[model samples]
Target: MERWVGKVAIVTGASSGIGESIAEKLVKAGVLVVGLARRVENIEANAKKLATCKGKLYAMKCDMTKEEDIINVFQWTTKNVSLVHILVNNAGGNPGTTLIDGDASRWRQCFETNIIGLLTATREAIKIMRDNNIEGQIVNISSVLAHSNWYFPTINAFDDGFV
Candidate 1:
C-alpha cells in the first residue's frame, strides 16, 4: 500500500522466519530496510531476494544483546538512510523445554536474548527517534508464550516490561 514510502525501518533477527517476512513486507511497501541479525550471510541472501522493492536494503550483522552493535546499527542507518520510521524487534526464540526440565543456561540465554536484547535495542531506537524528533512505529514481535502458562515466568516478565 506504499504506507512506508520514504520511510526507513529496522528489523532484528531478520535472517529467517517471521523477521524475514516482516522485512519483505516492509520492502514491498517501499520502506528503506536495515535488517540486523547474527547471521550476516543469511540476511544478505534475503536482501538479495528483494530486488523488486523501490527502497534501499542494507543487511547488517548485529547481535541484539550487544549494546555497541545496536548503537552502531542505529548510527549507520541515520548516516546512510532517512531517519528510522519503523523498528521491528523480531529477535528471540525458546526451544521446547518445560519449565522444570529446561537447562539453566538455556533459560538464561532465552531471557537474555528475548527480554534484555529487545530492551536494549528499543532503548537505542527511542534515543534516535527522540533526538531526531522523528515520530516512528515500533512493531514488537512477541509470542503468545509471553502470556500463556506454557512458557517460563521470565517470558511474562519481559512482555510486561515492554508493555
Candidate 2:
C-alpha cells in the first residue's frame, strides 16, 4: 500500500461488486482512482464514503463494450488526473442463460465484456504506463465458472464449456 501512494489506478465496472471493492481499496491505499462504469451515478455515490482516504476518486461513465467509451475513459483520466499505474479489469457478466438456448447477442455481450473489454483496457493502460515509465499492476477478476463445467440451471451459461 505504501508503494502505491500517490499513484493512479483505473477500476472498470466499478459501480458494484468486485470492481467497487477494488476501487475502494485502491483509494484507501492512496491511489488516485478512476472508476469507470455504465452506472456512473453509483460510483459517484461510493466516492462520498471514501472521502477520508488519502487518495481521490473520479467516477466516469464508460460502457466497457464500446471501444469509443473505453478510449474516452483513458483519455479523460490522463487529462484530468495522471497516467495509470494500476488497472483492474473487473467488468464482466453472463446472462445466466444456456449456451444453446442463449440469445446470440447475450453471448456476444459476455465475450465482449470479459475478453475484448479487458484487452482494450489493458492496452490503453499499458500505453499510458509505457509513456510514463510506470510499472503498473493489472488485476483481472475471472469467473469461478472458468475452471468448472457444472451444469447449474441458473448459471448454465457460465460454465467452462463457454468460458
Candidate 3:
C-alpha cells in the first residue's frame, strides 16, 4: 500500500462491501481513489469520514451496465487527474435466476453488468495504462459463485455465466 502512494486507483461499486473497504484502505495508504457507483452519495459520505487520510476519495456516479457511463468515467478521470494506475473491477450483481426457470432480462442484466461492464472498464483502463506507460494493475473481485459446481437447488440461483 505504501508503494501505491500518489497513484490513482479506480474501484467500482464502492458504495458498499469490499469496494468501500478497499477505497478506505487505499486512501489511508496515500493513493488517490475514485469510487464509482450509481449511489455516489454513499461514497461521498464515506469520503467525508476519511478527511484525515493521506490520500483522497472521489465519488463518481457510474452505472457499469451502460457503456456511456463507463466511458465518461475514464474520460473525466484522465482529463482531471493523471492516468489510472490501478483498476478494480469490483462492480458485479446477480439475478438469482435458475437455468430451468428464470427471466431472460434478469440473465441479460447480470451478463451486461458483471461480464460486459467489467470487460469494457478493463479495456479502457489498459488503454490509459499503455498510453501513459504507467505499469498499471487490475484486480477483479469475484465470488464463490464463480465456481460452476456450487449450486443450491432451494435458492434456484444458477452459478453459470458468473465472473
Q: Best by lDDT, which number?
A: 3
Residue-wise C-alpha lDDT for candidate 3, range 1-163, written one tens digit per residue:
7678999999999999989999999999999999999999999999999988999999999999899999999999988876899999888876776667878888787788888889999999999988888887999998766655655642333232354
Per model, state how many residue pairs clash. Answer: 0, 0, 0
Pairs of residues clashing in candidate 2: none
Candidate 1 least-lDDT 10 residues: 154-163
lDDT of 2: 0.85
What value does the lDDT take at residue 143 in candidate 3? 75
Model 1 gets an lDDT of 0.79
TM-score, structure 2 vs. true: 0.91
Cα lDDT of model 2 by residue, 1-163, tens digit: 8989998899999999988999998898899999999999999999999988899889999988899999999999899898888999888887667656777777677778877888999999999989888888998887776676656764554432345
Ordered by TM-score, highest first, the candidates read 3, 2, 1
The all-Cα superposition gives candidate 2 an RMSD in Å to the true structure of 2.0
**Model 1: per-residue Cα lDDT over 24-135, one tens digit each:** 8888788889999999798788778887777656899998768789889989988988688889999987633545555677666667778778888888888888998988
RMSD of each: 3.2, 2.0, 2.1
Give lDDT per model, in order.
0.79, 0.85, 0.86
